[model samples]
Target: MDRIAFDIAHLLAGGLVLVSFMMIYQDRLYALLNVFALHAVLLSLSVSWQAYTQHAPHLYVTAAIALIFKAIVIPGVLHRIIRQMGIHREVEKVVGVGVTMLAGMGLVAMSIVLMLGLTEAADAFAREDLAFALSVVLLGLLMMVTRRNAVSQVVGFMSLENGLILAATGAKGMPLVVEISVAFSVLIAFIVIGVFLFRIRERFDTVDDVALEDYRGEVE
Candidate 1:
């Protein structure tokens, strides 16, 4: 039973990392949002599995928050925002898909090497989960760096947070308050970024980060 539970948890965590890779190659805004929603769904499942295997019920609330807010509400709101701003169909890319994917694979390899080395004395489950979480986080950073759109950058930031949540829940004896705090912090970030996106659109008539940088006299 323990081995089975560990395998399931590993599968879900790996699924989250896989979805992060999928997010990297999405050039269209709507498609990126859809993939992000899928990422959140995978995260929720992973967290719920952690809750079950660890017998920690508060993690369920964390999973539910991921489902309701990250998976549904954030994507829905971002879709509407992009539609209203008239950039729903715009395709934005700052790096070639091949390069970004190769970089992502390197990050994953680095994560596995670093995590396994650091956690040599830790349980196998936690070590694997932490490695996957680090990969997700690094991939999210890569996404943010390789996208010129503010909306896509926001998705990347949220994906990074998903990795943090996964790492927290994977570690045994994590407090409920910490999980709740992390969830609420992400909610606050989403709200702030949503408003920021509108403000950017209002001033520059687009959400391209390059435009905003030029407007601020910053050379990109």
Candidate 2:
């Protein structure tokens, strides 16, 4: 049963990483946000499964945070902000999709090869978790680099934090790092989103980051 549970957690974590890859490949702002929301939900499930495997009930709290904040509230707020600002369309990409995807594939391969070498025999779950976390981290970076908009960059950053949380939880004993991180990320995510949304609105009258950068104060 323990082995089976561990395998399930590994599968879920892997699924989350795959979703992050999809997010990297996204073009539209709404699609990116929606993919991210799904990514959060999958992370929650993966964490909850990890909790079940490790017999740590506190992780349920982490899962709850992921669901409430990432899956529901964050996306909800972003959707409303986009609607209000009338900017619900594709964010500009700095690089072409094909090139970005090729880069993303490099990241995913590096994650698996590097992490598996580092934690070769740690355990069934730990090795898998590390690989997935690394993948998520890389995917987030890819998303950040490929997107020209600040809002999309923020989304990528938040998703990177999600990967960090996954790594912390997968370690032995449900460490202090995971618990503190969950709380810290929740606080940071909400605060940053609120501030950015306003700044985005104030400058461009839209949540589009490309426009805001263009509006940055210039010599008269």
Candidate 3:
């Protein structure tokens, strides 16, 4: 039973990393949002599995927050915002898909090597989960840096937070308060970024970060 539980948890954590890769490759805003929603769904499942295997019930609240907010509400809101802004069909890419994917693979390899070296004494489950979490976080950063749209950057940031949540749940005896704080922080970030998106649109008539950079006299 222990081995089975570990395998399931490992698989779910790996799924999150896979979804993060998918997010990096998406050039279209709508497709990216959809993939992020899928990412959040995978995270919720991963957290719920952790809760079950560790017998940590408070993790369920964390899972529920991921499902309701990240999976559903955030995506729905972002979709509507894109539609209203008339940017649903737009595609933005600062780097080629091939290059981004290769870089992501390198980051994953590095994460695995680093985690394995640093966590030699940790449990196998935690070592794998932390490695995957780091991969997801790095991929999210790559996604943010390679995208020109504000919405896509927001998606990247949220995906990065998903990785943090995954790592937290993987650790044994993480407090409920810490999980709740993380969730609230993400919610606040979403709200702030949503408003910021609107403001950018209002001023520049678009949500392209490169354009905003130019407007601010910043090198792009």
Off by over 4 Å in 1: 176-193, 202-220
Residue 88 deviation, candidate 1, in Å? 5.2
Candidate achieving higher lDDT, 1 or 3 = 1
Ranking of predictions according to lDDT: 1, 3, 2
lDDT for each residue of candidate 1 in 1-220, tens digit (9 for 90 to 100)? 3888988998999999999999998877899889999999999998888888788888888888889888998888878877777663654677789999999999999999999988468888888889999999999999888876777778888899889888889988687635564666577566647655655452223446665676777874
What is the C-alpha local distance difference test score of each model?
0.82, 0.78, 0.81
Looking at candidate 1, the ten consecutive residues that score lowest on lDDT are 198-207
**Candidate 3 stretches greater than 4 Å from native:** 176-193, 202-220
Predicted structure 3, TM vs. truth = 0.86
How many clashes would you count in candidate 1? 0
